[model samples]
Target chain A: MNLKTLRDYGRVIFYAAEMALRSNLTDSFVLFGILVQPIIIALLAFWMLGDRGGEYIIFVVIGSGMTGLWTSCLFISGNSITQERWTGTLELMVSTPTPVSVIVIGKILSNVLQSLASMVLSYTLAIVIFGYVPTINQPVLFTISLLLTILSYACFGLLISPVFVLNPDVQRLQNGLEFPVYVLCGFMFPIALLPGWTTPLSYILSPYWAARALHATSSQWNGLGEVALSWAAMVALSLIYLMLSSLLFKRLLRRARLDATLNIQ
Target chain B: MKAIEVRNLRRVFRATIGVVRRKIKEIVAVDDISFEVYDGELFGLLGPNGAGKTTTVKMLTTMLIPTSGEARVLGLDVVRSAEALRSRIGFVFGGERGLYWRLSGYDNLRYFASLYHVDPAVSRKRIPYLLDLVGLSDRGQEKVEGYSRGMKQRLHIARTLLHDPQVLFLDEPTIGLDPVGARELRQVVRNLQAEKKTILLTTHYMFEADALCQRIAVIDKGRIIALDTPEGLKTYVKDLAVIEFEVYGVPSNVLEQLRAQPYVHTVSVENRDQKQALLIHSPRGSQAVPDLLSMMNGIRIGNVIVREPTLEDAYVRLVGGEA
Candidate 1:
């Protein structure tokens, strides 16, 4: 990978998000939808887990935050390409020798940056307004969980990049990933609450492990001691999804015999 | 040195169905077309919509892999040395909406300039000159979104040239411009010609192709049916000279008589000032004009005009489609 190319992509992604904010989107709209949306969902978790709901708010906040990042990952990636199509700018991009990674990296970095900023803002509000900071035994261990959670979610975002290539219905497609992830993974509360086989199946999904690991981090349970073990599971899923997504992207790139220009009319 | 070379390129896209079904529907957009664009020639891939012109351009530019066959740009094998090939070339795809709308045209240029690895300081200096070249120097600070279509198109051209590439692939360079804007764009093409830049231009406008291209490949349905200079192709088809007349009070028999003339290929009867008119086609233009005008009698001929067949007529004949 060319470092310059990577830098170039990062610049593009940063510039794109900045451009988007000034013109098409509102500060409140992006903040409220991305940050506040999860908070609202967390309230539902509070209501459901009433009377002993401190742990549940943490679960809901983590889960909702995970979902928030999750939606934008694929959504932004897909929309960046589709928006390129929608706005008619993709052809100009494809014509240059700019590495394809620049596009993916640029898009993800922009979304990641936005999501991270939004994540911080949301957590701030939650701590002040909702009166919650995840309980932790060690700051160092909590930092590791935070890093891993981010890495895992980021990989999740990258893995879904190829769907944009096949056919981009960005908004609708983004909405599709939300409910299933929330229901199957105990993004809020516990997996035991999910009925039938979803409990077992949810364990296999990345977010389920992500929420579980975060919960363990907050509680200092036996599951927390297995934190080192958690890396292996998260890394395993990250590798699989990364490889699969890369292959899918390569295949689609080959098949996508599109000119640098899509027909405008 | 040949700047761009294509040999029997074939690209087939599989139009896939939904998730469960797997079937390959072959869309042979570019099918086995070959040509060598010599260094510094303004070569044109001239065609109408769905004529595979852009596909051929894409294959040469290394955007789409040719399913079979080969291409080399600036002596680099397109498939084998794609990165090197891509880095050396500049490209402008017509009707581009991919620019950052909020960024000033200057900023956009500078961004691409950065991608080319140009030094920031040099980019700052070079940008104004390029913007000036494209007639957007003063407006460079303004956001691209506010610029008119023609201004954006000019800026797009300026952006492609940011890296100082040896070859340029301009697909439909002047697609949707007003007549004056079209003239300005054609002038830009001519100026690029003066600089001796190797360019592959794809255009729907026949006149632009005729005026600017040193050689043109008339493509249709994924293949080049004819390749030559505009005049050379025109010569292949029989040149027709047409003359139109404004006349009045001519009898029905007189219109038939004009068509019966050995030199008059076609005649049309119409009343101009409550009079009769005849449109005649002949083998020769100026030579046939005088002879045809002298024959009209018993009816006043207001005015007579003669002209040679245009490139539009030549293209129609080349495509084997009657106009």
Candidate 2:
């Protein structure tokens, strides 16, 4: 698209994100996923991996935080379009000049941002409740990795929102789709512990790359080359997801409009 | 030039009914209907529930593609150029459901303005102007959930006008509102029309159609049975008149007998508080009233009155009392 069109989409994204954040402020279920769930996971991981020594504090914090992010992505960002349908605004959103995918990107951005709070909370828990210090070995690299992680997750969420809307049979399995990703991505543990056959699945998931980048930057300095490779994988996977999401969005709109299912809650 | 052109537009829904056997039923919601809405004209599609009014509006607004045939708004094809058409057209499906109930009315307008690509600068001024236009200026900060159905509907009107779209489609804009609220909404509609905006309004409320629409199309069973001006539609029953009589209980066979009588067009019974008001449409008018009493000699009758046929009478006749 042209610059002007891009600017307009950006404006929509900003407002839609703002709206999503505002509406989410009072949602107890969303709060639990973004805040409570991660803290609980962090607490459990802290005790389980405590024997690994104090150096692993940052690892526990990052791992538990990724769980919160994935949970929010799975429940909130994934259900963005479905939520609009429930509010009876799906048809209106579809009728607008702005593409629904842009609005959904805004929502995913908000969800990911909200999910970051879990990381901060886990860090606080390690320092205050557990009496441990968490540090990032490569602060600059970690920040860059965090930003890319957000982008990758946002793109992943983009792919997820349409899939849930277009195929409810897939959506029906949403509850079961969560822990598998957490396990495959090694949110609180390394994937080397899992069977070798599952390593391919972990490699394909952007989350696993994200966890690797964050864990490497936070606790151990995995060499710049390895970190760069993880970053590249996330970037490439994000682009692929973004392209696939656009296709899914087109299919979703056509199916919903043709089947007259846009308003079906 | 026509503001809206629909040529043999149709929409069919394939509904799966059975769980085990999986039977698919095809429902023709809009069946090969065609019409043109002229520039700056207020047109009404009057039909009862499930009469394809909404399906037609949805197609014109680019929310749904017609199963066959074509629809255009402002010279832009709805299907092939839906993206281009969306910015030029606005629509509101009436009810409380379409709004973001959690957001303040002002926030809702601002959000929709962004969706319509209204410049932030323009929206800053336009939002308050629209809130004032819909009489929600004072309540702009209050969440929509607190607003009455009328207030919510007024907000819907304000939301649709955000982009200053050239053509507007309102599907049942005042379906479940108090009489005062309904009147206020009608006034807003008139105001919109006076601004030279082309409007296509769909409602089952015949009186609302009669009071507002410059031209109307009576739709029933997925087809446009009649298209005419308000006065022109009234002429459908101009040759006929309504004969009314109040009775406690009218026998079903007697009502049937009245229908079989000569000069009697249609007989309809309306339940009043403690009595039934029987309305008979006939060309004979009062001339047929005397024969009606003879036929129900033993029935307790109250007051008898004869009146001119109304647009409602025309609708009842056109749709065969389905309204």
Candidate 3:
């Protein structure tokens, strides 16, 4: 990247990091809600399936980490929108010359980092405590899976904030999302374990694809051809989520309670 | 060319009601309005709550697209050239929510500077200069959340000017500040003017508008009812006469007679303990004040104060008064 691009990305990254640090630095217990719970799930998996199950536990841990990051992005729409809707910060930010992209990117970037932190920490803890390790035949897909997982979750979460702008009650809509996501993504168990009727629904959710991809890395997920399909399915899901959310997000913002969204100075 | 040009700008928002199925209702937030601010001059868009001040600012600053009409800031069309316009102006909101509560005043300035594409080294030097200009140099290292309302306001002023934009739009810059803080903030605005930065500001404070605005447009019910220099606009309330007196209980009959007096045109009993305010106006000037004071007997009065029509009086007259 050129100097200008480097500076742009640097500024965006710093803003994201600063937002995370300022908002969450003092709240240590948030780990219980986001991090420790995922770790505990991994431990529970180890307990259930013994050494064979450790791989599933690691998959759950990473998937949950992805969820934390994605959820924050999703959370930003309701959290920041409802907040700016209440406090006037949203209006203030929007009214100024700050690039709309900057604000959107800033929210996503911060969510991504915070989510990444949650993921890395849980994975580290799982490594130290549960002794979870991956089969290393192909590291590229593993890296790509995590990156794509982050991309898919963040973009989907990023799109829904404008709903909160139009309705204060929309923030509560997020709760309905968590249980359905956890169940459908098969994070708690294996996708094969879910009822046959729910299979189509799981296929559409990005996390379902993410959970399966990361799980394949550990469970030996059948063979190369099967693993490639999982990877391809995730890529398709990411694109679909990315495109759909951007369109929905733009439409919602265009129709956003522009007056109500004024965040106070 | 005008630094800012607006042509019949408008924005319509839909309001919704109910729960199971919401009913969408249309609210015309910004009605048709148009005015241009000159280059290197301070203009004020003075208004009360819901007067479309914020919406107008949003349209001018290129945040909300005008549902109709057109606005060009520094010659760039608001909708088409929004990104370019962002670099051309600075905005300082009157509230304390935008700045990072955790970062020091300097850090906040530096952060915004980065967004405006200011070079890092230049920003390092520029931030301290801005902090010093707003008289927050000593407290540059202080976290924004810890700063008093006054200090936070000063930092906001510094933050807005960090990019050194050619134009500045300030929304109620001194909204809740105390007397001293408000005065200092106005002075900073004056300095910005001296440096030739065009300012389009909005405020409810009449005195602030009088002090800083070379020209002001007072918006009410989504319309610009009055637009002129503060002194010129005060003339609109020439019929409003303010006379204060410290009286030891004036009889009702005597007060009623004073109200009927020919030269004593308008009268109002405003609430003040031991002090009665009789707003006396006449087509004839201060000539009526002496005659009215002489007519008052059986009442011990202290200092029948007659004051010239103020901008507050003009604003009240122009905007109208009611509960």
* Candidate 2 residue lDDT tens string, A132-191: 888789999999999999999999999999989888899999999989999999887788
Give the poorly placed runs of model 1, Cα more than 4 Å off. A1-32, A46-57, A127-137, A167-174, A219-224, A258-265, B10-32, B114-122, B231-239, B244-281, B284-304, B309-313, B320-323
Candidate 3 lDDT over A6-83, as tens digits, reads: 666567557645765566555554445455655665566556654555555556566667556545655553465565
Instruction: Let me know the TM-score candidate 1 reaches against the reference structure.
Output: 0.80
Candidate 1, residues B58-109: lDDT per residue as tens digits? 7777777778999999999877787777668887777646577778998889
lDDT of 2: 0.92
Candidate 2 residue B253 Cα shift, in angstroms, is 4.4
Q: Chain B, candidate 1: TM? A: 0.79
Put down candidate 3 lDDT per residue, B1-323, tens digits, no spaces.
59999888888877788998999998887788889999999999887788889888877776677888999999999888876787788777777677677778887787677666677888889998999999999999888879988888889888778778899999898888999998898899999999999999999878888888999998887788888999889888776566656666667677678778776655545446767655555555666767777767666777677677788667755675310
Please state the CAPRI-style docking class of candidate 2.
Answer: high
- Tell me each candidate's i-RMS in Å: 3.6, 0.8, 3.3
TM-score of 3: 0.83
The CAPRI classification for model 3 reads as acceptable
lDDT at A69 for candidate 1? 65
**lDDT, candidate 2, B166-218, per-residue tens:** 99999999999999999999999999999999999999988999999999999
Each prediction's Cα lDDT score? 0.70, 0.92, 0.71
On DockQ, the candidate that comes out on top is 2
